[model samples]
Target: MKKTVTILLFLLINSLVFSQSLVDLSKREKERRARLKGKTIIIQKGGDPARKGATLKTDPSGLAEETEGLDDLTSLDRESPPQKRMIPKTENPPEETGADQKDATDLQKLEEQLRKAKEYVELLTLKMNALWQEFYSMDDMKSRDEIQRQISETYLNLQKAQANEQKLQKDVEAR
Candidate 1:
């Protein structure tokens, strides 16, 4: 009798968990259906319409008319005359020297490095702010101390990255 009761209890708990998941899945399906209800669906030639995926739909409303403006812009581009070349034809065309190419490559690398450094600083600043908030809301002293140390480290890294970015910017400007 005890074994039977135990098995029944297990089955009841399992059903409860599965039923909750089913309810959640149905809710999500309803929401997805509602979102796609009014949208038109395009069925591919060899594709099954019953398949689950994104369906392309043509806009039948004023939105379609609004896109006609973009079509007109494209048409205008086709109607316009071709642009003339900026460089004049000569017997010997000017070529880029090795040093010029190297300088250009170095400038691009510096610009990219500076952009990465700035992004790093911004990410660090965001992390520091989030850690600060977490530290304030914490009830434990040890956790708060750990979060505070993380905030300090992140802030220091942010300052270093910002300094490096400034130096790279100056180098770029000097060139």
Candidate 2:
């Protein structure tokens, strides 16, 4: 059985190696040369056909002289009118009215409130983390329960402060 499997593996490997051999190009080259030998080749430098020189004729009245079956050609030197812009014009500049001034003051107050709320949230978060660490090290169940409650309350306070900060930010943006 081992010998049969080895022979089959060797045959598969050999078949794959023989099937992937490089293609022969000599026959194709000979055929291509034979086909090109009877053709008249015109080799251009830029691969474009050579342009025949043609001049535009103008009449005595400074108009383009028409040619047979060529009525679509216009003078290339004519000046086109300037294009008009489609954008709307803002004629009135923004002025600071009383309502705008009130909004600015309200924004300032909201920013101050948000700053304080963020500081409160940070303090509560740090206290909660410290309590958690302390709760892990405590051996008494009562102390651990107390620490857990404190941590929960601190987390709640932090969430409230964060919510207030977000509300203030939204209010400022709305202004």
Clashes of each: 0, 0
What residue pairs are clashing in model 1?
none
Point out the worst 10-residue segment of candidate 1 by lDDT: 71-80
TM-score of each: 0.46, 0.43
User: Each model's C-alpha lDDT?
Assistant: 0.60, 0.57
The prediction achieving the highest lDDT against the true structure is 1
> Candidate 2 has what TM-score?
0.43
In the range 64-125, model 2's lDDT, one tens digit per residue, is 43232323221111111222325565799477899897887687678777665655565456
User: How does candidate 1 score on lDDT?
Assistant: 0.60
